[model samples]
Target: MTETPLAPPSARRSRSRGRSQSPRSNEPGQNLHLRVPYITRNIPTYDLLSEEALDRIEATAERILAEIGIEVRDDPEAVRLYREAGASVSDVSANAWRVKFEPGMVREILKTAPAEFTQCARNSANNVVIGGKASVFAPSYGSPFIMDIDGTRRYGTIADFENLVKLGQSSPWLHHSGGTICEPTDVPVNKRHLDMVYAHMRYSDRGFLGSITAPERAADSIEMCRILFGSGFVDNNCVIMGNFNTTSPLVLDGVTTQGIRTYAEAGQASIHLPFLLGGAVSPLTMAGSVAQCLAESMSSCALTQLVRPGAPTVLAGFLSSMSLRTGSPTFGTPEPALGSLVMGQLARRLQLPLRCAGNFSTSKMPDGQAMQQSMMSMMSAIQGGANYILHSAGFLDGLLSMSYEKFVMDTDMCGALHAYMKGMEVDEDALGFDALAQFGPGEHLFSTDHTLRHYETAYWDSALNDDQPWETWSEQGGIDAAQRANTRWKKILAEYEAPHMDEGIDEALKDYIARKKASMPDAWY
Candidate 1:
């Protein structure tokens, strides 16, 4: 593994030259820290059921699996793995399975786990320590979507994987580059997994969340991270089994459970996200939907804790809307927005780091609707105190599409929220006691030394938004926020430079990936 190069003392000095303009005062940003001690809560006496009631819910889930079972049409390997794992199979068909995972088995898989994990960034300066803090950190880009360079449209593509990693590295608000950057349909399925992993390592040295594509792919992704960051090194901050989709009613599929165990044994964190579609798969009422979502999330968190006590895990609840008439997915709905707010508060009650979506737009373009929806949803999550906000950017149309302009806009929004979360400052200096004494009532402070010294530090600066008069705005480009965002994106892409890796490390990663590909059966790809 290549160690990150340290900056020379002179180089550090040069970077700090102009930084005194906004000196790090004895402020909360420097001194304050929020911690979430545990990931589970005592079952609320009201919500808690008698042992008999608990048995009923578990029995119902078991019956659903035995009768309905889950659909696994995409991967034959998944089918084989499930059958081998003792799941009942369908007659004649080799793909389907009726998996009945015992509740105890699920509990055993979650005990004795670590409480927090650390994620390394491209530069050692940006590494994020997750799980232990009051909030976990992850990047804005993830959803299965792609944005056009023209900043007008979006489509899905494998190139999104590379671009998202780049954006993740540049985002101070984001902590980890989530896995599954669009679907790599252009490449072979098995090869696509390795390709995405390689892209993340090359483009950004940040921690990643693993996908539930296939057990083999999941295992390979972890192994690749191990090779790059060293075994146990990557494990500390990485989430191995992420977004394990439950077959609603709270049953875990065999393949999903397999991925969870694989990561658990490797000593990596796991997150369970019960993705529910309200008004369709779940109840139409927001409270009812949230109740179900919370129950499912708790079940998974409890199971994870039972399997490995303190196994660093997150409670992720993504409750979105499903059109009743059309049955199509809907974004920008009040249900999800309200539900997410409640979920964040609930996670706080559990003393667990919560992962929810924020700054996500359902609009296909960077228009007023997009800004409105994104801001509304993001504020709800942040003010509600969501620990980790995922899919924070580049999303539209229910997370099925992306826009470069929208992504840049989201970056700006994220910066604003970060400033908001920092909250009001109260100190003798902030109170302007000396400045007040210098300039009495009705006197101007704008020209004062104190104001001149701290104005920039006192507030956030937005690159894409301006409140200038129409005459002045027209004299300039008179462009919309999206256009300004696009310009900023280009500037960042041109100027940003990642820290260099050691000699031959890049080639070693490529060669290792090629060798792994060669070892796999041809048909698998």
Candidate 2:
């Protein structure tokens, strides 16, 4: 068998160009670094529940949908669509309707959604495929406050948002440029989405998410994509995605349902997620919460198909376990991680791409607690076979804050995951029979030819970890991982160069933003 590198073939062909000292330690910027467009899992998904158990959970979801029903608030169009699609609809109030589906109605309606599709990036090489055995890593989303390098927590500005986008673009491990890396509190509430979308367009060429706070903002995001990518291309292909959340305990609010329809009608992709907090918005029991999540997400995703058949949609689950005594939210716990695993199984059963758990933590700082918690949550996403993994880095304070130091630290972990998910290949080179023949019982293989040929690319090298002896560590100020991550992020930002864009396209995009912003006066609320 031929000897091959562990990374995807696409990764081996790429190289770091004009990069400063890499944030990763040990490896220089000029080294033979591997970069995958997205993770194609070679290993099998870990199925924790039996088929019978999964069937039971799915049945429970159907029961919830048929009996209890989901209320559509302030969206008559959504209510009418549900009614046309064979669901029972009744008036809950003048502005709300109770829409209930038969046991199999939702499953049939979801048949039009594609299982997998490509989200194109400005640079074609960075295009990522969602669904099947592929997985994409992206940064944390929707953080209003940031934990600064000096440990001060404050509101995020547009500068901070741009910097985060730059950091994501610079990392070889992250596939998609995430949405709402943090809220630009300094910008007006009505107009900040334009700036956020522009930052993703100018600073990064990777596929990214769009705004979903309102339907018009969602339309604005799609319009900007048309300027960057041609109109025909935008209409026919998926260039951008919107991440929308459902109000939990069986409710699809107007803003979210309308947002889903907006992206679907435009032929773009959307992730329908139910952010369920156990004991609060959902059932206290894990199984009950999982069933509720499936019901809520499935109904919301079906709306996308209703708007336009064969539109791309991703099923997402954000399950959190809350403290029973104080009713506070918890993250990176084992229960929710288990919930994520189960959700993966359910998504596969439905033949849809899944977005699951991430590097979640409640720790205020980038300490041992943070890493430990992140590993527990992130591993579930990896082992469970999720397609798009959001919050892949920099999540802290129960997701109330995005830590700058934690962001780089989490990227380093993502680098390791790139290797971990590659699994292993067994071949002629891997057998190493020639080395065994040359070495005696008491001899070592250190100087063998096989060792020399493969040593450089043998293992995943970490950049932030210090493995030196105590004396060397002490001489170097005994810096910890967080301190090292702090230095690295600053270094990365200082050297970051925005990917080049065409002059004409840039001007058109700026003109669009200017006209849009000028139309609306600054509304800070």
lDDT (tens digit, per residue) of candidate 1 on 240-300: 4355666564445557666655565565666777777776666777666666665555555
C-alpha displacement of 137 in model 2, angstroms?
A: 0.2
Task: TM-score each candidate.
Answer: 0.77, 0.95
The lDDT per prediction is: 0.59, 0.88
lDDT of 2 by residue, 1-525 (tens): 011113222122222333332223324642244567788898889999999999999999999999999999989999889999999998989999999999999999999888888887776667789999899999999999989668589999999999999999888888889999999999999999999999998888788999999999999999999888878768777889999999988999999989999999999999989999999999979999999999999999999999999899999999999988888998999999999999999999999999989999999899999999999999999999999999998999999999999998999899889888888889999888877677857789999888887777778878788999999999999999999999998989987877767667889999999999999899998
lDDT of 1: 0.59
For model 2, which pairs clash?
Answer: 24-463, 25-463
Determine which window of 10 residues in candidate 1 has minimal summed lDDT. Answer: 36-45
What clash count goes with each model?
19, 2
